[model samples]
Target: MRSPAAANPAPHLHLAELNSFPPPRSCLPFLVRRAETALRRRAHCHSSSRRSTQNQLHSLQIPGRISHGNPPPPPTRRVILLLLLVVVLGAMGNSIYKFLCGVCSDLSDAAFQPHGAHASVAALGRDILEFQRTKQVPEGLSRHVVSSPAAQANWYKKLQVAWKKARPAPTTPEEAGRLVVLTLKNHQKADVDGLLAFYGLPHPNEAGSAPPPAAGHHAPPAQHSAPAHKPQGVKFELHTLPVDAKAVADGDTVTVYVDTNDAPSEIKKAAAERTKARAARNYPTADALQKTIAAAGYRMVPNAKGVEVLAKKYRIRLSGIDAPESAMPYGKEATEALLKLVEGKCLTVHVYNTDRYGRSVGDLHVGGVFVQEQMLKKGFAWHYTAYDKRPELAKWQSQAQAARKGLWAASKPQEPWEYRKAKRNGNA
Candidate 1:
């Protein structure tokens, strides 16, 4: 059972006793040192991965000083060249932008620049607007306005185009004046004021309100305190004298009057003469002059308080209707009916056109009530569809017919035109 030993066995004599004995003491320290060295190598190898390597490199950095690694290889030649190129491109772009802005300032008249405007800008206001409107180069404006007709026309053409391009043409004086100054640039102040005044536009000196009336032009009566300027795209409004008891003629005919302030010169003179003659107690002369004044549609009528005032008269035919004649049935009733509606009230007549009979055919409005609508609804008038085609009139007439109101009470009522025709032909 004894194991074999080395060939030169120094006889320890008992090989079986070697199993109980340890090895040499110097070999223990050497083995322990080798084991420690192996663990250190493994730990260092495990921490040297890419992330750990990056962390090690990052920890070596310092601001403004080279603490450890070479300073990033002196910024690669390609990178340095690219940085230079970017700086140069930015500088060039700035220069180009400035040059374009300078060009724009110089060429564009609208832009504020040190052009002719820089030297001395004056007001050309309404002279500019008038020039645009008429285009007739005024005499003596050759020097003050423009150098020559060619230049004036060129300026005028520019203004004309700009005026048209400005959508919805200017309405008020202020709007017109603003547009005028903006369109025609680099003008003198006094000159602009004069030009604006010429066209009745608001002057810059007046702040923003309308200018005064022209020479020899009386202002419209203050009772209406009416807007001197009209609403855009709307027909001018006209007012009638206060309706007296006798002003209503029939359902379709009314004797309306306007203020003598709006009368013609000759009519005004006749009225004045009549007033003077009456004051002088020259009854005959006063009567003749009164007739002349009346013939010219100027009359002196008593108001609600019975004070006689001068006014211009008009025989307005209610537009779109032909009521029963005063001699026919419902004739008196129709006159009384219109009188009740319009008595002591001032009417606003929107005159569209004049009839062949020399009467102003217009839609009459008493406050909010339409005089024609009232007549048609009451069955006192027929919708003269031949002259006017308003659907509301036809509709109202149909309603009256269905309800058997007014003249519709008759089994078969005759239209006013038909009655007139019968009377004219002596057949009724």
Candidate 2:
């Protein structure tokens, strides 16, 4: 009983001690220790809260599941990266599709375009000339050739045959003109006048006096009147041996080669100089005219090749003279005058040079008569001073002008060059 009471008394005494008004000053130490312990407990709680916050922050930075909340569906970074990759791949695929479509459109345009007929003939002529010079097929002509090697070979062989069949170099202007006509006639029919114009040759109608007096019409008797007095210094030497007239081109051009011992003589030069002096006098005296008429009996026709003394296959341009084009005023008259001089006659041709048209530029003589001088005297053509610098031709032109001959009869006559220019401008 004493022990139980004492134990109970000890509990009661401890309670009584706690309930006392104030603890001793010595107990302050224990209170301080308890306060320190409570502060330590608060610090520990604060540290744990800080650690939890740090853990939450670290989870947000990781872009994956959050530790506190429901784990984020998937990492935001991974989804964003996957979307970016898909976008990049899509852009790359779109660029490659556009480049392939452009190439196919260009090949279709080159395969078809029409080539002209007249153009083909011109091209052929150019090719022929080029081949003669270079011995190579022209690039322009090659387009007409077949693509296959065998076909091309056959085409070339045919071309060679055609070349051999064609006539040789033309000996006269008339012959040259006819050669062009015949060539076109054989290959394809074309307007003769138009073809002549195209080839830069004077039209046939403009090349001589008249269109050969039609087919069957007979020519009128020759008018043999001449200047009255003989030119004092002029000496006439007749070639007794006759040479064949190979060709006659225009009013004043012819092609003839000597078949006999009578070669081209220096007499022609002397005669030319004397003629120049005579032309300078403008009008011949009446006495001289009478003498010239008497001497006209000396006119003699020579053996010739072409029909009516006109070349069938040669090309020659009249030297020192230009006849009016058929399109020009008085052009027909000029041509008619030329025909009257040379048609049905043998001529002596003196080749001077070659023209751009591949025509022989030369002086023609009919029965020892200077054809160009006759043409000028008759007012059938201009002296073509640009090409012929002899003052004699100028004087002849002046005389014709004074006499109002041929084209000079017009109050204002247009030059052939001017007429051609007007035509080109579409102003005619």
Residue-level lDDT of model 1, residues 269-343, one tens digit each, is 777787788889998998998888888767887543355678877888887888888988888888988887676
| Candidate 1 error regions (>4 Å) | 1-236, 303-307
Cα deviation in Å at residue 365, candidate 1?
Answer: 0.8
Tens digits of lDDT, candidate 2, 92-141: 76655533433222122111111232332333445444444456654432
Off by over 4 Å in 2: 1-313
The best candidate in terms of lDDT: 1
TM-score per candidate: 0.44, 0.31
Give per-candidate clash totals.
11, 23
The lDDT for every candidate, in the order shown, is 0.60, 0.46
Span of ten consecutive residues with least summed lDDT in model 1: 113-122
